[model samples]
Target: MTTVGLLYPGHAAEDDFPRIEVMIDSDIRLPLFHTVTDGDSRGVEALRAAGEPERLAAGVEELRMAGAEALIWATTGGSFVRGWDGAHDQVAALARTAGLPASSTSFAFAHAVRELGATRVAVAATYTEDVAPLFAEFLEAADLEVITTESAGIATADEAAACDAERVKELVVAADHPDAQVVLIPDNALRTAAYIPELEERLGKPVLTANQVAVWEGLRLADRRVWAPTLGTLFATREPPPGIDEHRGIEVRE
Candidate 1:
């Protein structure tokens, strides 16, 4: 069976792995590795622990030992809290160490938007108010326009995952801008993995959530991307833009 690696934070958000496995069907395996994280909160200590190069390498190496074919740094804030350049460096380091294609949730979000050809986006961030703006900068750096953003002011990963889907969808709608062509929920802790279709139906536009995109990016790197009607727009094939080469998928350049 095909296997992909997930380098997750050391928090209590337990829905990710099982949800991803179900989303991918029984055809693939997800080797989960937890990188150090001091708390479920998104603070300096949490960021340092989650994104530290040496610790991250340890997790990647562990996944490599598990025979993973590709790697995903599945923590959104962990990757984006460092600036755009730092995020790029973080994923590059992982791919070099793992000797396989790799991506972080931050880059996965960007690539999913580009692949969907949606330039104007609304962000429903599940971070604290102070922490949410950083993702706006990250998206801008990725060349996508953030029409608007809203934060749920959630303090921890566990909190975000346990947040009800209706509430999350409410935040997504509140975050929506008149120009928004797509809505993005940028938190791997979030449990919107199964609600993609319903969310899109309510908003009348594509909704891309963190875990959903991470799975897509994982399959993408493994050259296993195929149509999955349940994954909403990110799984649907679209024409690549002028410069991107989709078959190779998400190169961070080691």
Candidate 2:
């Protein structure tokens, strides 16, 4: 069975793992490892203040020793704190440390949106208003337009993880835009896979969640092009395959 390693912070949102399992084929095994980051409450500040690449790389090595064939840094805000270049370097360093394929939730969202050919997007975040723009900047760098956004102002990774599915659904529903071809929820801890079909049905647009896209991106890095109807439009759409060779400095999938 193929194994994917998820490098997340301690007390991260729990919804991500289940979503990954549901999205990937049963043949894939997802083994997760948690790296503790400072702070216990406040989403924006905590993510902004999370650990650096060196610390993250050390944690990734543990997963590698455990036989994780590919690695994904599962925190969107933490990876993007250093901006695109820094984020790129962090992923590269982790790949080097683990000697395996690597990617992150931030890159996953960008790539997934691009793959879907989505130009205008609406963002629904569980972060504080202060950190929402960071997510916007990351998306804009990938060339997607942020047409609208809704922030729940929830503090802390634990709180984001503990958010109820109904509240998440309400946030998505409230944040939906008529001009948005895609609605993006970029929190990895939110259990979004189970609601993709429902969200798509209601909005008549593709809904891409952080965990779903991150898992897909990690699999793609491993040269595993997988598709499933329940995974929503990101998986349903086709784009030129990702150039693994180009990502050599970033990660390697054997």
Candidate 3:
């Protein structure tokens, strides 16, 4: 029974666990921690301070005390605001505070994109358009090309969380680029896992969502890899590196 701790702002998306369950066949516990923001929100402040470092550290400690083998920060915008170096530092600090492996949704996406050997990617975001560049910068730092981006200009966590899945699919389809080999829907606030297989089949490419990559990265931190057709390329083809355990708590693979 591998305990993967998901640190999010509030209650998680109801549909998140089914995808994770499809990967790891064991008793999985999701201990939701309270943060100052709503579950489906997005903003620089929401990402960076919903759970401040002190609070985040405390949350990590709580999960460690509860016997979580690995920790995953389940918000993409949250960890990404700190930029690449800041994101790396946050994961390192959390790992040190919790005494276990740590990873985040942003890092997870980067790893998943690279693991699939995808060099060009199209991104569809349900955030203010301002966030696209930040996301692009983060992905660029990881050496993945951001071929195109589309944002819904949504404001507030509640609205972002309440986004209609059908609309999300439409946005993804609209943002698809001919040159892009992969499409990334980088927001946990939107329900993406449930539609990945169908979307991939239609696009003839990989489609990765925030929650899917976050869970995948958490499992990888535990030295696990899963091949679920529903997860698209990240799960279908990612290979874990040797001795990854030594760096799981700090550095992320690129």
Candidate 4:
């Protein structure tokens, strides 16, 4: 089994990983280790601290012991709030701390976007206004065009998690843009794996969510390509090789 360690923050939506495992039924194992965020705040300062080495370090040994071949810092808000360079630094530190190749949901989205050959996307974020725009900046840094962004202004991960399936559908539908090639939901806290297929169908486009892309990123790091038909378009496709330019945040090809 290929094991990808997930250094996730807080309690919300970690279950999505297991659901993905069951849906894919592949040998890829996603063992999530929750790191603590600063209290309940989803603000920039709190998110920056949440991805810091000290918080992430606590879970490394456990995941390493679980035979994780790679690690992912699985929160879009945490990494994006730190901006592109800072997000790269965050994953670099995680790679060192865990003694494995590392990445985050922010970079995961960037790589996932390029892997699908998409250049423009719309964001459906569950973060507060003050926090959500940074995600757009993060994507822009990766050379992607942000067609539109819809922020839910949800206060905390818990509140975001409380959004029922209908509300999740509404948020995604509201975020869709005619010019967008794909719709991205950058909140890992929301339960999104189950709704990927439906969301894609409703929007008539690719739907990329935090948890979905995180798993896909982990699989990429482990060098395993999985075909999960029910997991939506991202899963239905293959990772572009040699993969994203880790240094430049763009797609790399021979």
lDDT of 3: 0.75
Which RMSD values do the candidates have, in order? 2.3, 3.0, 3.7, 3.5
For each candidate in turn, the TM-score is: 0.91, 0.88, 0.88, 0.94
lDDT scores for all predictions? 0.81, 0.76, 0.75, 0.87
Better of 2 and 3 by TM-score: 2
Top model number, lDDT: 4
- Show model 3 residue runs off by greater than 4 Å: 12-15, 22-31, 38-41, 238-254
Better of 3 and 4 by lDDT: 4
Question: Which 10 successive residues of model 3 have the least lDDT summed?
Answer: 245-254
The 10 consecutive residues of candidate 1 with the worst lDDT sum are 245-254
Which one is best on TM-score? 4
In Å, residue 226's CA in model 4 sits off its true spot by 0.2
- Model 3 vs. true fold: TM: 0.88
